[model samples]
Target: MGFKNFRFQVVLRVALLVVSIFLFFRLDFKSQYVGTQLALGILIAVQTVWLIVFIERTTERLIKFLNTIKYDDFSENFSSRGEGKIFDELYQRYNEVIRKFRDVRSEKEATAQYFQSVVQHIGIGIITFKKSGEVQLINNAAKRLIQVPSLSRVDHLSAEAPELAKQLLALPAGQSTVIKLWQGKERIPVALYVVDLVLRGEDFRLASIQNIQRELEEKEMEAWQNLIRVLTHEIMNSVTPISSLAGSVAADVQDYLEAQPGEQIVLQREETEDMCMALQTIEKRSQGLVRFVHDFRSMASVPTPKKQLFEVQEMFRQLQMLFQEELLQANILFLIDCRPEGLKVLADRQLLEQVMINLIRNAIHALADQPNKTLQLDAFSDPDSRVVIQVSDNGTGIAEEAQEQIFLPFYTTKATGSGIGLSLSKQIVRAHKGTLTVSSELGKGTAFTLRF
Candidate 1:
């Protein structure tokens, strides 16, 4: 209402000033009325100046309000003390808008802080980086998961998970993969996922990683243990008694068969011979079954790795010497190469050698049927500084169906295979916190890769 009154007063004041000007124009300025005319002129000029000052005062306040918002100056306070109700109401509106802005800003800041805390506290690791691999953000969970104090780039992860660094960079948006890694002496299987982000018109990738072995494999391993226990218990129970009985009977039958001719006169010679052979067969089979059960038990109970740093060149040299005679007899062209030469790995040397030997032996068997056989072992450092060892063969490759189960215990394609070697080799590599991966195509070749 005061503002309305002020507007009305301004209009009325302007009309009054116009009337004074008109009167001055119409005045009869004679020598006797000169002083009166001059005084009237002065009054009109003073009213005009008063109007300008009043309008400028309101304009000045409007300008100040705009500056407050433009500069995000929430500290500004509009007070209407002793001013007319018009100015007081205007000040209140300004203050109201400023308070709203302040509230919005506070809410945004609070939201940011809340999310930050959540990211740092979550169990799953989170990493956000630019396309160039520059790390933008890494949560505390991520640092803890990788066992690193700090990471400035994604490629730095190569030292921890050999192929993880490369995989993260090349991972498609919304895709996921599992990476095998070692923490201390325990093997950890990590599931990595990636998503695309466009923020402020710049592209970025956000990756989340979690130890899947802890969440998924622990239960699976427990079930396997249960199954192994039941099998070992049942098999040993059934075979142990049979093995003892068969051995005792075989010994008694052998003694009877070797008795003097007079002692065995009642029975035919052929009958005694058949009885001894049957008892011996039963004893041998029963003993073999017992050994089979023991093999599985030992496979299930792999020891923790005792890791130490060693050069690949020296390891390859020893392998060459070990397989030298076999390669010569098989007529297989064996090639070993270790580039940039001093490539090294941290692992159990004996266990790694066992894995290599198993793979090589399998390759030799595979090449047994090939006319032109070739076996190659190459070791080098990858782009991320991870040591990569690959054993390849130009022989009859593994069948597609069989490749899937090749790493399973007691799963073998050979007639004389115990079916435990490949599985045990895989377990040994895992124990060393490494991976053994196979790629093969029938009749072309097969390659087994080890990354550490």
Candidate 2:
């Protein structure tokens, strides 16, 4: 019998014996008193031993079940056979808990698998980082985006693209930044979205990288389209009047030539001279138009740079010679503060020289009207492993509104300027794996710095 049933039977026997003793004592039954007392004592001893054994077995089973749970054996279920009635309900509850846990574990595994699949298949780059910014996970797309080396880990992106990396790292939680990264010869524009995520009470950042090449291309096309429209308008304005004037002059000359032989020779000669002058004016205007078209086309057809190691000081000396006459005419003081020896850099010599010429010419122009005009061309090496060349002029500084658009194509502030020089120079510098940046303030001279 089960322990609970055996305990119950023992209790019933004790009760019966106690009642028999009571009856014997009350009805002068002393003769049976000794026997009844002895029987009750024996029954009490046997029941005590049985109760101790049952308690020991029950405690042992409970300890075993608890140990099973501690070892993560949630699949094991306690059997009800031979167990006390008190433990039957407890066993059933424990089994139910194990079943629920199994279901939950299965669901969790499925969820993890789904996320893994998504991360692997997605085209965009995905990276996860811990709160301390240590990389936790990166997908194939992320590797491709950064051009990660096979043997190297991307623990610090700042080392690769310092300016862009700093901007990204400074972004607050739930914020994002877009940066342009140079991969070899191409500029890849990427948008980074930083998101804060909490997992098991710990915080993390999930960075999603999206390639914005198409968007950048669209914006570039739009800019070129606008430039084209402006150029077209300007060309038509200058060409139409010249064409009409030339046609009118030709017809007038033809009519005069066909007039009667001796009709007012002096007056006809005077008229002929005036017509010839008018025709020359038309020719000059047309020639100017042709020159403008040539210059514009030349600016548009800038060639890709073929980079080589060269001395920057040599380039500067050549520029100084080329613009010596202009400098003398303007009475401008030209100063060169380049290294006494040489500053070496990897760049396209021809393109670099073009950029320098454009900058120096602009500086000369700026100082043309200044009372004490000075143009300084300086070159030095920066601590960041870059060669910096600065062109500064003490002249009428750029206006605030025009400074921003100074580098844009066909955006000249000068009344008699073509406006494509600075833009083309910037393009050339960029093509040589360098940066051409400008900073200026009204009433303060402008400075253009080339970093290589």
Q: Largest TM-score belongs to which candidate? A: 1
Assess the local accuracy of residue 61 in candidate 1 as a C-alpha lDDT between 0 and 100. Answer: 73
- Candidate 1 regions exceeding 4 Å error are 1-225, 247-274, 381-386
Best model per lDDT = 1
lDDT of each: 0.82, 0.73
> Candidate 2: worst 10 consecutive residues by lDDT?
147-156
Instruction: Estimate, for each residue in 1-452, the C-alpha lDDT of model 1 and write its tens digit.
Output: 54346666688779889988877766777677788788779979998998899778778878988998899888888876534677779989999999999999899999999999999889889999999999998998778667788889888888786687888899899999998665543345789999999999999999998977534534544566577788888887877666676677668667666774455435568866776776777768777887888777977787888889999889988998999999999999989899968878899998899889999999999999899999999998764477889899998888878876787778889999988898788777767666676778888989888877
lDDT score of residue 65 within candidate 2: 69
Q: Report the Cα lDDT for residue 194, model 2.
A: 82
Count of backbone clashes for each model? 0, 0
TM-score between candidate 1 and the true structure: 0.59
Off by over 4 Å in 2: 1-192, 206-222, 229-248, 255-288, 304-307, 321-340, 367-374, 380-386, 394-396
TM-score against native, each model: 0.59, 0.50
